[model samples]
Target: MFEDKIEKMNENIGTIPMIEYEKRVYTPEEIQDILGVSRTTIYQLIKSKVFHSVRVGGQYRISKRSFDKWLEESDEEL
Candidate 1:
């Protein structure tokens, strides 16, 4: 059912190639690597809600969507 819906969506939105969507979840380590921020500062950002994160089990994971949006917003200012 879901596959059929996706196929219909693709047909309706034709002419433009559809790239497969990526799973955009990021770990704290990945976020730190991307942002080049300290682990302490990462925690602060997560705590202050400057970075968007989802809690799973015992770890909090950041969303790649939030990071991409942040990059776009910052780029617009420059």
Candidate 2:
């Protein structure tokens, strides 16, 4: 269901729309929405070091590349 919606949305948006927030990294709330996880789960993943985060000017930012890599490698664990 989610995948179908995502595909349709992407199609409607022409695959690559301009992003106003492209330069800025995502916060926990943004990650939560993107990953379809709860706030607690996001924190747990961060605490367990499953995903690496970096602190910058008092805000922690997750690397999009590293997160994608983790997702790719994580499927093997199941």
Candidate 3:
């Protein structure tokens, strides 16, 4: 039942656009790869709120915009 609506929605991509917020998130693993850091360090930053993030369900979802802005302002070499 729900699958039919999803299929219909996909077919009408022109009329129904994807949400912008959905594209603005970064996962912990992606952050690790980008920063060359470990999972522990990533969580530490998330906990410290060095950038914007929110706990969704059991895990954290970092904002890509906030993270990039933090990087630009910080002295940390990428």
**Candidate with maximal TM-score:** 3
User: What is the lDDT for 60 in model 3?
Assistant: 85
Error of 3 at 54 (Å): 0.6
TM-score of each: 0.63, 0.58, 0.66
* lDDT (tens digit, per residue) of candidate 3 on 19-72: 775569899999999999999999999999999999899888999999999988
Better of 1 and 3 by TM-score: 3
Candidate 3, superposed: residue stretches over 4 Å from native: 1-22, 75-78
List model 1 lDDT by residue over 15-75, tens digit each: 7867898878888888789889899977887888765898999998888888678768888
**lDDT by residue for model 2 (1-78), tens:** 999999888787765767675533557777899889999998787777777787778877887777777888987888
Instruction: Count clashing pairs, candidate 3.
Output: 0
By summed lDDT, which 10 consecutive residues of candidate 1 come out lowest? 9-18
**Whole-model lDDT, model 1:** 0.83
Of the pair 1 and 2, which is ahead by lDDT? 1
What's the best-to-worst order under lDDT? 3, 1, 2
Error of 1 at 26 (Å): 0.4
Evaluate residue 30 in candidate 2 and report its C-alpha lDDT on the 0 to 100 scale: 75
Global Cα lDDT for candidate 3: 0.91
- Estimate the lDDT of model 2: 0.78
